[model samples]
Target chain A: MKKRATAQEVAQLAGVSKWTVIRAFTPGASITEVSRAKVMAAAEQMNYRPNLLARSLATRSTRQVAVFVDDFANPYKLQLIEATTAALQAEGLVALLVNINEHLDHVHAILNADQRQVDAVVLLGTSFREETLADSRLRDGGPPLFVLARDSQLAGIPAVSCDSAVAMEDICRHLAARGFGRPGFMSGPRTLSTALGRHRHFRDHWASRGIEVAELQASPYSHAAGAAAMRAYLAANPPGARIDVLVCENDILAHGALDVLRHEAGLSVPSDMAVVGFDDAAPSALPGYDLTTYRQPVGRMVETLVDMLSGRRPHDTIVLRGELVLRSSA
Target chain B: MKKRATAQEVAQLAGVSKWTVIRAFTPGASITEVSRAKVMAAAEQMNYRPNLLARSLATRSTRQVAVFVDDFANPYKLQLIEATTAALQAEGLVALLVNINEHLDHVHAILNADQRQVDAVVLLGTSFREETLADSRLRDGGPPLFVLARDSQLAGIPAVSCDSAVAMEDICRHLAARGFGRPGFMSGPRTLSTALGRHRHFRDHWASRGIEVAELQASPYSHAAGAAAMRAYLAANPPGARIDVLVCENDILAHGALDVLRHEAGLSVPSDMAVVGFDDAAPSALPGYDLTTYRQPVGRMVETLVDMLSGRRPHDTIVLRGELVLRSSA
Candidate 1:
């Protein structure tokens, strides 16, 4: 391999001091345009690239942030990852992504993040429990921790999440206005605060109207679980017996419920069983499903997350609301 | 905020030297059990945590690898990201993820990766072209670059990619064995080598069998593009006119084509028009669409990529084949 040209070689070629060569490459450093042009021309000609590793020794700022996400298969998590990484880049911070599952391996992953000396760490998952937040190892040694899209309210730790309570109320009201009486919920796992809160709101809102609600919680936020739950519910209720609508906590669950309705039960959607879901994932908008759902403001939520990480905004539990999108499913 | 405790304070509390304190915390560093126990007790009592950034100045290895990926919405890309991150973590390296789109932003992202002084860079995308591979900026000053899942053959650069040509040949033979004739291809954009090679193989194999093929190229690797292409094809060919099966270049496109067939075209999947796809993403196994597709060996590919990055394997173009999975769709 050919040896890379050094700053000293560039300085000699440009007929300038080493200090001028360094200043030309440094952002916001004061240097004359004539000297900068000469240095750039010489560096370009000789393929001179500054060694950032050596420079970081003097600056002591790596400008890197670590982001932890648990569910890689979920489309919502994927979208959040995209937005978070882009926002980090906009702020000139590199995003070090860590795939932390609910298993014990996540503990090692978190410790690795601590060892990397990231500027901050963003916890972006729904499955992280209070114990994860309360881990002394994560709290003491790691960089400042912030939660996004999950309700993690540990001491001195802040979170940014979607306002699922208000959205659920809005959805319930919308369903009632459409003359839907019998309602059922295809719920996600109760371990997640977001799913638990949404389920509670759904039950309370419908109970006030004197309507009994039926619900089943999927083992995890997955399509197969949704289908299995729906199938089990149908086995008990029998076909042609009515549940006017099924409100799914996530789009993936709703897709599974729809699949069960069409294929297993031989029931037509909306005409026989209307369906609604949250988090307007890409597939829900397709012609086959056309699911009516709530669209989370991921772009705005990511901006707030970056601001909190950079200390530009206060560390508080900030919540954002999303509007309901009506499609053919309802 | 409380000021963090230092190694000097721990050493004083433990009645040991500063060097002993440092070695006790360092991974794999040799120190006596008694000294390590005393240092740990002191650190626990005082809430002391070593700063990695300060130590990196002496060690010179940040143990970070930057990964560049485009098209975040694609499920295949998400799967690749998950596998890549886990592999890097297994090797004691942090994955610095950069979400770059097909725009000028990727150029800046690459430069930032160079400036961060990561140990290496891994390009994990199918959309990257020769122009991106040949950019002098990436070649001159950056850490060693390795392309994964793309066909890059630049001088001094190595790539590990899926053998799409052989996989396509296997798929065609499988289809012919299943009594499928008059096959149509839902092609992706022609700029990508993976897509171009797959399309070329399909054409050659079908032409040798004396069968005519219909092809439509999508604007992007998305479900919407697949739906549009299928809609155009159906409009051109009347209902009940023979196009026996549709072979999609990817799962997202296949999902779109299935949507078009079931909803817009008012046709059943296999009985009316069979369909197959590449990249057996999570959604393909859903009950709604049991899509027959090829599953890429992501785990093996990621292992090879890490081996190449760490100089454990030769820097040559390595290709792996995917297996075809049969389901109800075909």
Candidate 2:
């Protein structure tokens, strides 16, 4: 194996000092451009590297933000984490990611265990809520926090999320406008407010429109669970007895349900069964699934969340719209 | 909105003191088992939390590891990050994620940046190899290095990787045995050692068996690049070139190329074309892709890497075997 390149080796080959190589990597450092080219040429020849750690350590205020997320498998949350991290990194901030799925106590333990290494926290798809108010870490002089989607009663905190109530009502209207006869809804676990809101809104809004909901209950937001739900429904009766359309809580669940229908149950999408999903995860949009679903304005959410963290949009709530991507599915 | 629960709230709810609730989150902190259960039960009811920062600062270990990856869009790397994070969290260590697409310098900046807090660094993919090695971050007392892949000659460093060259030979032999003719291969950039190794091994082994090799090169391990490379290959060939078999560098690239073949190029998998992927990312086994491929043991990689970090494993180099998964796409 070749020895990893070093700045000294390059310096020796080019007959230049090690500092010359440093200046080449350090953008706009005070040095002759010709010397920089020479350093690069030499470095290419021998692969010399100067220590970047001390330089990084010397530069105070590394703009790395500690981003806390739950369920890395969940595409919506993944997108949020990705969007926020990309946006922050573009602005020269590193993202420290923490998961909250272990347990609530452990989740907070992670926050404290991390020891405030992060400049601030971007809480994405977290279960953390008002109960943290009494914790000294959060209550006292802790790093400022920007929560996304988590509901809170207390004032003086900043948050950015799609207005859950409005987003849910719009989904219901879209389903109703499609002229669906009988609709069964497969929603996420009711524990999360976002899922609960969608379930409650779909039930309440559709009832007023004289559409009787057949099946309604909480299931984990996964393709497996969606497929299982579809399988169970199929076992209960023949295709004729099934509902005309099924509204899924999110894309993961929707894709799973569709998989069972198309692959296992041998049903065609939008033909034998029409389906609509939320969050519009990649798999759901694949040519195989061809899922027509709601898309949260993620780029906007990241923009507003960053602004909130920087104190640009404090004391205000953000409510964004969701678009329905029309496709081979519902 | 409900207030986020705290240890104090748990104390109030459980009829115990706040200190009791604090001790509950600690793994083995001394406290009455009954009281611990009460604190936990109360904490669960109210979603109680404690300050992990103040305590960790006192302990002087962040209990966090910063993970640097090229991009999360590559499903394979995303799966590795997910597994690695789960493993770290299982060991009471949290992962801080960094996406280097928009800014590669940010990753080094984080690792070398001393003021930034972290216990160690886990470089996730090939991106780490590209950074100038002479940089101090690669050497010196920068949190003990743990890289995954072929032996990188950074003295006293630890590495983890599946047997890529041997694994490619396994696939090539299987294709040859199946009477599949000279195949079309999609290789990652020549700059990447993993890509270079896999491509070279596949070519040599196929030539040994007197099978011709038609190959395409992608910029990086990604879906778009995979699609673009295939498009270039198809454009260069005659209408009936019959490039029936494809071996992709990884799962994400394979899926991307599959999408282009089905949607754009108008071909069927396994019938008109057989495709295989590496890294067995979870989605590859999902309903649509169900790719025929090699499964790199991520669980073992994380466990082995962490054991190396914790001194459980000897300083000798370790290479693992990849599991071959055959699905309909083959």
Candidate 3:
């Protein structure tokens, strides 16, 4: 490997102090433009770029954020990852992606992020448990924690997500208008507080309108799991006694449920069974699916997350409203 | 912010040297078991984990790999990202995700990764251009670069990807057996050498069997782009003049083509027009699509990449054969 040009070498070439060379590269550091130009020219000529990892020791800021994501099977997570990474990059912050699904538990992911000394940690999916986070050392002296696209019940850990209560109200109102009396809600195996909170909002919103919602659980957040859950639901309940509409917690589950209803159960949508999903996934707009779902403002949520991390916004739980997209399915 | 416990404090509490504390935390560092146990106890009590960034300065290895990904709309990229991050994490290396789509060009992403002093850089998608990479400073003393799921033409940069030649031959034989003479190939706008390489392999494989393949180009790798390309093709050529089979470069393109055929064009599969795609994405297995596609050995490819990055394997171009998954689409 070729030896990299050090700051001392660049300073010697530029006829400036090593500290001047450092200040020339440091963002927002006080340095004359002439000195900065000379240092940059010398550094460029010598193929020398300031090592961020080395400078991070003195500044105590790596300008890298640990982005924890799970539920890779969910297509919506892709949009979340893209938006979060892009937003972080726009703010000159790099995203250190931590695969929460690969580890034995979420605590391992958190501890690993802590060891890296990232500026902050952002949880992007819905799989993290509040209890696990509370019990972890992250709460003691680790980097600041922020949640995106899911509510965080842990104290001092700010979160930005869609307004699920209002979204549920919108969904229930639409279903009531369509005269769908009985509705079934499909959710994943995660027992996080936000998951339960979404279920409660969904069920309570329907109950207020004199309708009871049934609950269905999928083991994991995948299309196949959704189909299996729907298949099992059909086997347990006769067609005449089945729910009129199915409301899935996310779009992937909804796609699975819709497939089972159309192919396995031989049922027509909106006539025999209507289906709805959340997160208005990319496929939901396609003609094949034409799914009626709620669109979470992922771009806005990511912006809020970046702002919170950069101290541009207050570190508190912020909920943004999303639009309910209507289609033939519901 | 609370002050983090330093190595000095941990060493004082453990009655050991500061170097001993670092050795205990390092993976392959030499330390006595008694000293390691004492350091561990002290670390747990004081919550003093050795900072990886600080350690990277002395060791010159950050144990961080820069993973660059583009074309996020293709669902196959999700599987690649998950597998790569999981494999890297399992090997005690963190993945710093660089969003190539967000940057002005691939060169910016490379330079950003270079600034971080990552141990290696892995390109996970096919959108990177060799000319752009060659023009960048990456060719001049940057970290070792590796390409995953795509062939790299640059000298000394190793790549691991599916064998496109064999895959095309398998596809062509299947098409001939089905008596489909006229076929169309749909590709994205990336003009990289590998993109043209796949096209050449497909066209040449079909030509050797006395069949000429038609070409179609999609500006971007998205469902909407695919649909637009298919719609344009159908508009330009009427029913009798259209190709018998449409082979998409990726699953997302095939999905768009399939949706247009079924809904807008009012054509049936394998009768009026048959469609095939590469990369058996998650939705390809759904009953709604049931797409005939190629399945890349993502797990095995990621394992090879990690091994190559860790110096366990030689830095050479590896072409692994993928399977031709048959379904009703073709």
Candidate 4:
């Protein structure tokens, strides 16, 4: 590797003291234009650039944020990460991503981030355990913690997510207004408060309308899991079941259920079995699926997150509303 | 926010100087057992954690790596990022991600990362422009740059990726063995050497075997782009064309082609129009697609990358082979 040009070398080349070289590079620092010009010429000739790390030590602000995510396989999580990074960069912040696939790894990453002294920490799609939250090591007030998508209900923790309960209520009413009678819901693991909240709201709303509701649960929120769950449900209930409309917790699960309904159950979507999904994911908009879904306003959510971090808005539980998109599937 | 405990507070409570407090917190620092015990007790009582940023200035090593990615929407890239971050954390390093969506934003992010004095920089799926690579600002020897999944032929820049030429050869042989005659290729933008390499190899190998080759190009590497490209190709060539098999650049494009064949062309996959994809992405394994694809050895690639960054291996271009997964799509 080539040796980096230092301020001392540039200072010697410019025939000035090292302090003058530093002042020339320092933003808003008072330096004579003659010295600054000489330093700039020397630095440009020698390929010398100001060292940010040393400047950060003097300035006490790195403008870097640590971002944590539980799953990278899920497209929805990927979208969230992408939007978050773009939003952070727009405000002159860099995103330090930590993939918390394992609990121990998450804790270790958090410790490392604290040691690095990032400006803030953003947690995405994470359902952190209460023990982890209560650990005094994590509560050292090192960097401000903000959880996105998944709820972290611990005291003093800020959370931002789509209003799943309200979205589910809207979906249920949409189905009812479309003259759908029996409804079936497909979901991910019950441990996720996001999915559970939607499940409860859908069940309660359907029960209030005196309509029977059938439910299926899967884990890990993948296409295969959704298909397996649907197949298992069909085998137990047999074909020609009365469930006219199927509602899924997310687009991935819905995509799998759509496959099963057509190929396995020999049912035509919307005509025989209408399907609804959340997240209005990119794949769901394809011609094959074209699923009816709740579209989370990710842009607005990201903007709000930036606002919270910049002190333009208060750090608290903020629930954003999503749009119900009607497509061919429903 | 809660105020954090300072070393001065711990030192006052422990009846020792602030230097003793720093010694107690620093690893491998020489200090008396009596002073250490007192410092530890006071620190625990006062909830004091050593500030890492201040220590980094004294030590001059942050143990952080900056990761650059071009497309966040691509699941393939996300998978690579996830694996890379996990591998980095395993070796006591943190990943700072810079999303290069726009040229100016990318340059700004790069400059920031350079200033932060990260240990290294890993660029993922980036086909860097000649001007960007040749610019003295980027070449000022800030950090060791390693490009992943892109062929960067620039001198002093190391690259690692799947052996696209050999992988394409294997795919051609496999297709020939399956008696596929006319073949069609779908790809991302030609600017990407990864896609262009695959395209050239496929076209060359097919031509050598006296087979007709059809090609379609799409920018942005998205499902909608793939679908639009397929629709355009079909409209120009009409249905029932001689192209019996379609080989896509990635699983996403293959997915869109599958939709087009069924919905637009009214042809069944494998039976009438066999479809193959690369990357073996999560969605390709769904029953709906069940796409045949080549699976890159991501685990080994990540391990090799970490090894290269740590100097366990020399910095140079290394190509790894992938496995051809036979599924129902082909």
Model 1 earns a TM-score of 0.92
Candidate that scores best on TM-score = 3
Q: Estimate each model's TM-score.
A: 0.92, 0.76, 0.96, 0.92
> What does DockQ give for each predicted structure?
0.52, 0.19, 0.78, 0.59
Tens-digit lDDT track for model 4 on B248-301?
Answer: 888888888888888878878898889999888877887777889988878888
TM-score-best of 3 and 4: 3
Q: Give lDDT tens digits, candidate 3, residues A130-210.
A: 888787577787999888888788788888999999998899889888888888899877575345367789888877778
Put down candidate 1 lDDT per residue, B68-114, tens digits, no spaces: 88787687788888899888877877788987866546656677676
Which of the two candidates, 2 or 3, achieves a greater TM-score against the reference?
3
lDDT measured at residue A176 in model 3 versus the true structure, 0 to 100 = 83
Residues A235-316 of candidate 4 have per-residue lDDT tens digits of 8885566588999988888988899988888889999889999888777887878899999888988888889988899988
Task: Give model 2's DockQ, 2 decimals.
Answer: 0.19
True contacts kept of each: 0.55, 0.30, 0.80, 0.70
Give one digit per residue, the lDDT tens place, for model 3 in B144-260: 999888888888888998889999889988988989899899987757434436678888887887878888888788899899999999999988899999998889889999999
In model 3, state the lDDT of residue A250. 86
Q: Per-prediction count of colliding residue pairs?
A: 0, 24, 0, 0
The sequence of per-residue lDDT tens digits that candidate 1 reaches over residues A115-162 is: 566778888865777676677776774678888876765777787877
The most accurate candidate by DockQ is 3
